[model samples]
Target: MRILGVYLENIRSFRKGLIVFPPRGITVIQGEVGSGKTSILMSIAYAFETPTGGRVEYADAFATPQPRHLLRTGESRGLIRVLVKQGNRLFLLERVLQREGDRVVNSGNAIYVYELLGEGGLQVKPVLKLRLSSGEYIEKLRSLLGLVEKSGRQRPEVFTNIIYSPQFNLTSILELEPSKRREVIEIALGLSRYTDFRANVSKVIDAIGEKVKGVQLELSRLEDTLRSLDKQGLQSRVKKIEEEKARVKRELEKVVSAREKAEKELEDVNNDILKVNSVIQEKRGLISRLQQENRLLRDKINAVKSKLASYTQVLGVSLDNLDEATKKVEEEIRAIQQRELGLRERLNALITREKDVIAEENRLDAEIAMLERRLGEVESDYREKEGIVKKGICPVCGQRIPHEHGLRLLAELREKAAKIKEELEEARRRRGVVREERSRLRSEIDKVQAELVDLSGTKDRVREAEKLLLELKSLMERVAEVASNEEAIKRMQQEVESLEATLREKKEKYASLKNELNRLREAERAMSNRLSELEGELRTLNDQLQKIQVLEEKLKSLRSELNKLVNSREVVKKVADMVDEVSRVLAQETFKFVSESFTTIFTMLAPDKALSIELSKDYEIRFYYATEKGRGLVVLPSGGQQSVASLALRLAVNQALRAISPRLKDSTLLLDEPTIGLSRELVARLRDLLNKLDEEQRAHIVVVTHDTDLLEAGSTRVRLVLREGATQVSYEGELDKNYRAFVESLIEKPP
Candidate 1:
């Protein structure tokens, strides 16, 4: 914990700075490139992690500028101050950054942390507070610059001493990138148990690739439901609806046999009108007895011609004309008294007009004998309506007779008894023409010769009305051939009962549609055997998911090639035990001053070129070449003698780190120009090994040079004199007055 003292203002090239380090050995702050001399070792590594000299931004070894552009950038504001000493406990910290309204306020809020304690020896003074306000005095100046130490009990989890090895970068260790150089050498070798075994095998292969993508998405939805149940036919459509219900029940039956032969020809015209109504009641009783004997034979022929004309006129006269007449009628009784006095006044006017013409011929012979007793009561009602139409109905109301309405009422009663027997044969032929004129006036009376009596009952009533009209037209043609064979057996019994009721309803709807297509073909054969046993268990889980993805890519390439062969065999056994502990601490601290500073920088840069140099165990430096008689050793490619044997072994590892913490580490030695490519006699033998250190092994020997022969081995010299932008150092204590005024400003070659 050292940073003895440092105070800076506007920090970058450090404007108003002051420095002091004298706690032990080296304290060099040589200036050259941009003349600030690594700004006094970067202001003591930014006051050893910002005592309060705040802007080390959080220390990757300090770079937090911009306190208003660290002041000289057109001047804004910046300041940094630091002073510390832990053992004797003196501390003074101050840091302030600004750029207010636009903000970049490092906000150490005008910090102040003082602690100068000494008490008995009486050097006590400060006890001030605001130590970087809450950053706890920059974490107590990073635990008093052991940088951040305190974890003792073997707590080495890799914090390589806040390493700030700047200069040209090693490309962060030879430009990493071999898996980031095995993650920065496993965080510089802490190796956190192989990074938790590669993060638990990448979380168990991401949960087994999400359970193999959910078993291949449920086997692609059961193979699309077994290919839509084999492209849908759905079982033959129930046998074409049972063959169209057996052809519409054979056809309805011949229309029921023409409606039963028009009801048997209307029953044979009702038995030929009941025998023509009994021959019209026997011709109406013979025309009512010839109209009453033709009015009694015309009243006996006018009584013999009226008594022969009244005896020839009462015996008087015209006897002379009658003498010939008397001779024949005295003679004919005078012609029957001229027809018996005209038939005695026509038999007294025919018995006084036959008593009203025999009372109008017995009132038309009692109206033709009451129309022949109403034609024998219409022939006993036409023989009881022909025995009620041969018993086929209507006896007085048992109604059937439509044999064409009983043959139209027996031809209208035989035309009303043949017109009353032809008006009784024209009244008996006018009574035989008045009895042949009274038998020729009875002069010859009784000449009778009547023998015409051959009436076989009028030819048996006209041969029984022509044999009952030929048996009613042969019983109406046998009832129209038995109603046309009972209408062809009721049309084949309604086509065999409608094809047995459509074959019993198509065998009960095709046996209930083939038992519902055998329960949908056993649910499509149990969903096609459950989609072929889930596609053979998804093809045995896709061959066990491709053998667990090729055994998780060969277990991630054998755990990244076994963490790169166990970090290259632990960085090659920690570079072979750090090159045997750095060659036994460089052979106990110098190794003959690193083999005489690489044979005096390769004999001042390749004298005759059979060069030689070598060191290993990781601090690495080698060069070899051989030809003249020695075999070929060949590796001498002098990049300026390997930059002057790596700047003289980094100034002998900064004087062996001030011979190991000469009091907590700040022995500084920074060389920037480093002799670009050494030549001037190898830069005067690298300033003759930096003047072979003496003043307590060169306690404050700072030497930065534009090579006026290494500032002529300056005891104390300083000279950074830029002009217009204002920077001036120019001091001298010895070096023969700053090496003869820096060799007269380099031979005045101010070209």
Candidate 2:
């Protein structure tokens, strides 16, 4: 697989940029410090997997940062698009930071995979979706790129291994820790795939164990329940309950039968009693009405007798003579009433004249009092004004005054007061005359009142006489009526007494029937209670048996599950062991292939040293200095040898990982400045090694370097210049005449 180009939008120092790799030979991407050469590689890394370890890819310069700081300065969103070609197919992978709000948010964390189509048109459309949605897409991508599914594909794992190595990291794999060295070796021989395969096998084994444990627990519980079931005892109890339930049912039937019979008798008795009660109620009502009529007739007889006796005593005669006496009394009452009416009229006339005279007297008296009060007010005012004048100020006018003016004013007030006093005296004289008139009218009013009282007394006498006459007449009529109905009333009293006796007999018969009905109902209720109790007991026993039957069925199902899981556990264990053995074999084979490559490359890079690669059973890296020398680390004594050996190991690894997947197999290596930090003597040796590599063409290596001597005529150089904080990368096709001359001067070729 080869990276054709990379497009970065809102990524560190390259706001929007594209860098394409040359199609053939070694493509060198060269730049000064901080020219964003490293950032371009990082952008590619972000497109594949984010961050690429120990770096916030889009956070510092133009990237959309994470969480709160997603977008960098002036960047609201960011995108990284990497184009890679494998065989005849090209894929474009784009990772976008979809900013949703003012602040940086994770709305843009989606990745879209596109396939480039239509010849060299560069038109691409989405083929897949990835990023936070699921990890399956990432696994698919790794497979397409010919990478180990679970390998942490760092820069060193792919590009930096043989193609692009930033400064300071150009060392042999042998100098790395044992684990890291092992990782490189294993990747080289495609053993990482087997390692992942082994891990999956182990996971299967764990899952089987967990299922086995759950099944075992259920089996144990089932066994415990089976042991505790007491089947024989349960059977015995069921039989007993069955027998008892049958007996209860039989007894319930008998009781229910008895209850039904008693209820029928109670119903018959209740009907009989209801009829008796209805007839009794009608007779009782008739008796109550007759008794009420007899009581009223007796009361009338006593009232008539009382009035007859009163009239007899008042006139000393029986009520039969009361009509003649009443007529005589009525005539007397009319004559007396006429005389009393005339006296009342005369008294009323005198009273009306007296009221008029008294009203006039009261009016004259009020006017006199008002006149006197006014005169007194004027006198008080005159006195107050006299004092004010003495103080040299008129009180009424609120003015200062001299003594002569004060005296004049006081004299005028005195004269006005005297005139008011004269008027007050005249009002008093008139009031006294009116008071005399009122006294005369009062005496006349008392005489009239006396006459009225006399007439009223006469009227009361007439009223009493009239009332006496009416009573006498009423008593005479009632007495006559009583005389005529005495026999009939006596007959009604006797009939009432007979009805009461009949009502009493009927009520007694109703009571007797009601008692019998109550007795029958009580017996029926007792039987019903007995039946309910028996039925309840039977239902309870049946419920218990049903629950036990359900539990028995569940136990059988649990045992079946236990049998299946136990079989699965055994089979899974065997598979786990087999996978382990396979992983070991693969690891050994991979170590051998990589060991041979490491030794051959190290010898080529440092011919004088002649080192050999060694591998321990645990895959630890070591170098045998010579066939005669003892076992040691794969590290070399010289920095140049160490750098060459590490490069060889990394190349071997990248080659293996790339070749493992059919689609991504390629012979491309991106190596950064390996000539850095080396002495001129060492650099010359590195140059010699590069010349041999160019001749061999075993791999296509893209070097990013300031080592001008490494550039050659056939090399396609991607020159990067620092422009406005961004690295402006130009491919060979776009390199200008003067720029090419400038680059050529800096590149030192092996003569």
Candidate 3:
């Protein structure tokens, strides 16, 4: 695809602009550095691949920070309507980037994009739009040098343009790690499978080593634990049993002391009975004295009554009356005496009763005291007896309590006495109680003793327990001496040992496996390395083969081309012999080509001292008069000469490309600052070249420059100047009667 013309507005350095491209040949775009020469090239790259290749706004390609600022700061939108030619069809690639713009893709207002094509004097919308669907446009555009297709290890245009090379990175390329170096080399050589193989091999080797180390560590820990288990044996049981036996012996002493206390209480109750008997005797004597006194008083009162009766009888006459009165007196006196007698008798009876009661009470007290004393003595005796029994002392005081056991006899005696005393005390308490109540209490006491017997019958259980403990201790000791019988400790030790052994076995197995796996991995790594080497060699051979194939094809084509020159070889040889003359003639032709019409342009743009242009076999340029005389092309000190040389070389390359093949044809010429080092006369000669092109060729030429010295009458002139706060395009075409007249006015005026 070829760009015939572009109507650009408010693009990067072009503000409010419309510039057309000529169809072919050298079309110089004389411009300063900030002018819109590169803008035209970028516009072509954007319009073709807008979504992926370039920014949406052409101003985004510059330092303008925002989209709104791209359009003279206040203008709302920008448009670059591109007129492109594909094959026989001419189509428009319009790109409109607005802040609030409606979406028009490629060159249309519809959802589907279309390109405007000119055919038969009519502008028709063609299906060859700038979209993924337009594969043909991409292919044709790539055929021209405008579109670049990068492949393989070639850096993409994006990275090359965006990334600058630093010295550190350049040095680091040689200082890469072994693996990293291999990786970069693999990438450069395109060895994809070998890279994956080497990575897998490294992982396998690391995994095997990890497994081996883990197993070995586990085995070592297990062996250490198992070794300590053998020392923890079964001698602890004996010490534990001896401690228990001593505890039981201490408990038996408590039982002995308890029995002694019970006996002492019984003795105290018996002593109280003895004291009561003595009190009963003293009360009996008092009862006898009171009874005797009562009898004497009654006899005396009876005698006195009889005496009174006799006196009354002896005194007759009035004595009868007196006697009667006396008798009455006697009777009354007798009655009073009788009453006193009766009172005395009652007092005696009361005293006797009191004595009897006292005696009885004393008896009871004595009995209770005796019983208590007896209980105490019995308890003391019982304690003594129990002590004798436990110490194996004699209980009967004469015969030793033999194999039957002295403690057993004493214990039996104490138990029987205790039961009898308890019954006796119970019976004494119920001395005046109902027979049934006494019987019931006795029965209850019996029941309690029976329960005690039942509780004590299992006393030997503790002894049996002690015996069993001894047996256990002996068995444990034996087990320590001989290993099999000790199940608990032995089993634990065995388990620890088994674990140790198994861990050792596992570690050994892991070691073996790891060794095998290592060997396999090493083999695999070696194989991978070999494969990589082989593949690298194969790729090198293939690249060499491809180069050789390309060379052979080139050689064949060259020979075929040279075959055409076979008849002209003599002429070519003659020309080759006169190389110096040919060189001189070529230099003259180059000078003539540049100094003829374009010399005036170069002279005007350059300073007065240096103004000439040098050309070579490929139209290579050297700034001679532009800087210093006979200065090499590279010796141009100013950036302006470099810009001029760049512009000239770009034009020369396009021309050569077109001349080589019609398929390699390019119609657009973007000359950036073509008249940077030229005089007004040289600029005028260059202006003639610009005006000399035919209308078809003129349609494709777009000159972007700050220099106005090369403006001509036939060209469409646009002047870029800062207005308000931004750049705006003004038509110099209408500034004067002609473009040359308008541009010359400034130079014509005094500096």
Candidate 4:
């Protein structure tokens, strides 16, 4: 890609300016120090270096203290718009930076790319407009410029390090450490894949080695388990255990037969016990029936005698006088009930009187409270009015008043306050009298309640006496009916005795059978316990045998897996070795090509010095010269030679890279202040070399320098002047007609 023109606004030392480049020749930008000569180049580089967003750290192409420092003093925002040409298509790339708080930051949509189509490439069409995020916009820009790196990542280093060399950092590639220099060169030449392939193969080998170790470890563990099984004589032990299990099983069978016999015997005993229990139960039932009849007879007799005794004790009367005693108790109970009713009536009247007193007390309290509230208001008013009187003003109205009138108002307020106080005192006295009446009524109510409670106790006692008299009357009626039951009771007792004797004999027989059944059950439980022990022993032996078999199988499988891992590891190791050899050979061939190019370019630039340079496989530069003794190694004689050598190395790498990558054939080469320390002779040689490079049309070359001698070689020489704190550009060489027109149009009206 080649830069057509660059337009900048509020960018370091340039308020507003545009520089249009020649189409296909060396354009030398010459100006005084700090005259914005370098600013134009920096702006173009900055446009491509703006982080389209990621963790990529590009070289400092702008050479500013910070991004915001690129903006002019007192300016809050800066813009760099570059017009790039790739083949027949033209693109406009824009980057915007603004000052944010204490830091310089890109605008939200900081990058914009557009394609110019239609006639004269003046029609603007949107290509990419995106915020600084995941690098999509920059990737598109790189694709347009053919600047995508070999690793498939869009890197700004191609422009900053390869195509455009920053001011005062022309030898940046040479100044890098050997490894870093090699890495940059390889990436530019699209040879980074060799390095990546080596690294990936190594990682794979490491992974395989780790897998091999794991498999070996597992195999070792399996082998150890097998050895342990052998040490324990597992096969023989299993056989012995099987034999023991068989013997235990036989014992269990014998025990099972014994248990069955015992269970049969127990069953027979249980049958006998059941038969005896039936007989015992029947006899016991008969005895219970006889005993129940006799108990009813005794309870009836006892109840009649108890009633006779209670009647005599409570009423001092026998069954003949029971009616008289009952009548007397009934009369006493009625008297006590009448007294209780009178007491209750008196208590209810007292309670009613107490409630009325409480109501009167509450009313008095309300009245007293109202009077007190009125008194408070009057007092407050009196105090306020007295103050008003002292001030000779009316309290109700904000108006002036005579002293005598104010005093009269205060007197009225005092009189009202005194009346409220007197009413309050009278209501309080009434409330006190009502409270006293309430207390007296409460005391009368309590006394009446006590009398009622005492009456209730006397009534309960009279009710009990009446109940006893009724019971005595009932006993007197039943006494004659209770005929002599002595004979019947004696006969029932004898029958119950006989049945109990028979039941006792049967229970004795059942007890003997139950003891025999218990013995048999105990014997059967022992046999069942032995059988369970045998079963447990058999299960244990079988588990041991299964474990040994599983171990043996695992050992066999592990040995097979170990052999497979070993074979696979050998294959991968061979592949890794082959990859290493291939990588070394590729690097050697690439280095040989770059070295030849470097030697040719360096010889051309410093033909008189007989300097022959060699680039090691590490990309280290070695300068050698012919000598009478032999070819010898030496440091560069001067800074001018070093500059030439560095430039030559850069150009050689660029050439080698372009030869490999056809897309970079049209790439631009930007050299900023390359003649800073070069002698006049060296500068002339550099000019000739650049002119030769330009004539060959190898790449578009743009040189920025203050050396007038170098300007002679440019087909288009541009001069930059600083005036009024702004940069102005003027073309100073014979130019092509179309290019002249293009530059003129850009000056008059920039697109």
Backbone clashes per model, in order? 34, 23, 70, 0
Q: How far is candidate 3 from the true structure (C-alpha RMSD, Å)?
A: 46.6
Return the TM-score for each candidate structure. 0.21, 0.50, 0.29, 0.48
> lDDT for each of the candidates?
0.46, 0.60, 0.45, 0.71
**Which candidate tops TM-score?**
2
Over 4 Å off, model 4? 50-65, 86-91, 108-127, 134-161, 208-582, 625-632, 732-751
- Residues 1-751 of candidate 3 have per-residue lDDT tens digits of 4555445566666665554433333333444444555555556544444333333343333211223333333445566556555555554554555644533233321111233344432233435334333334434444433333322222222211111111112122223454553343223222323335445545654554555455455545545554554222322433443455455445545544554554454455445544544444444444444454445445544544444344334423122233344344344444445444554555455455545555555566667677777778878788877766666557676455564676467667677677758866774665444434435545555555555455444433333333333333343334333233233333444444444454444444444444444454454455455545545554554554465556556555545554444435444445444654544554454335433423443443343564557544333445553333554444543654544343343333334333333533545444434455555665665566555543433324555556757556234555555454334444443222332332232112211
lDDT of 1: 0.46
Full ranking by lDDT = 4, 2, 1, 3
Supply candidate 1's per-residue lDDT for 438.
46
Query: Using lDDT as the measure, which candidate wins?
Result: 4
How would you encode candidate 2's per-residue C-alpha lDDT over 240-299 as one tens digit per residue? 756765765676566667657656765665665566556556555655665565566667
> Candidate 3: how many backbone clashes?
70
- The TM-score ranking, best first, is 2, 4, 3, 1
Which segments of candidate 2 are over 4 A away from where they belong? 9-15, 22-26, 32-35, 46-81, 84-108, 115-122, 127-164, 184-230, 243-566, 599-635, 663-669, 675-702, 708-716, 723-726, 733-751
User: Where does candidate 1 stray beyond 4 Å?
Assistant: 1-78, 81-529, 532-578, 589-751
Worst 10 residues of 1 by lDDT: 445-454
How close to the true structure is residue 255 of candidate 2, measured as C-alpha lDDT? 60
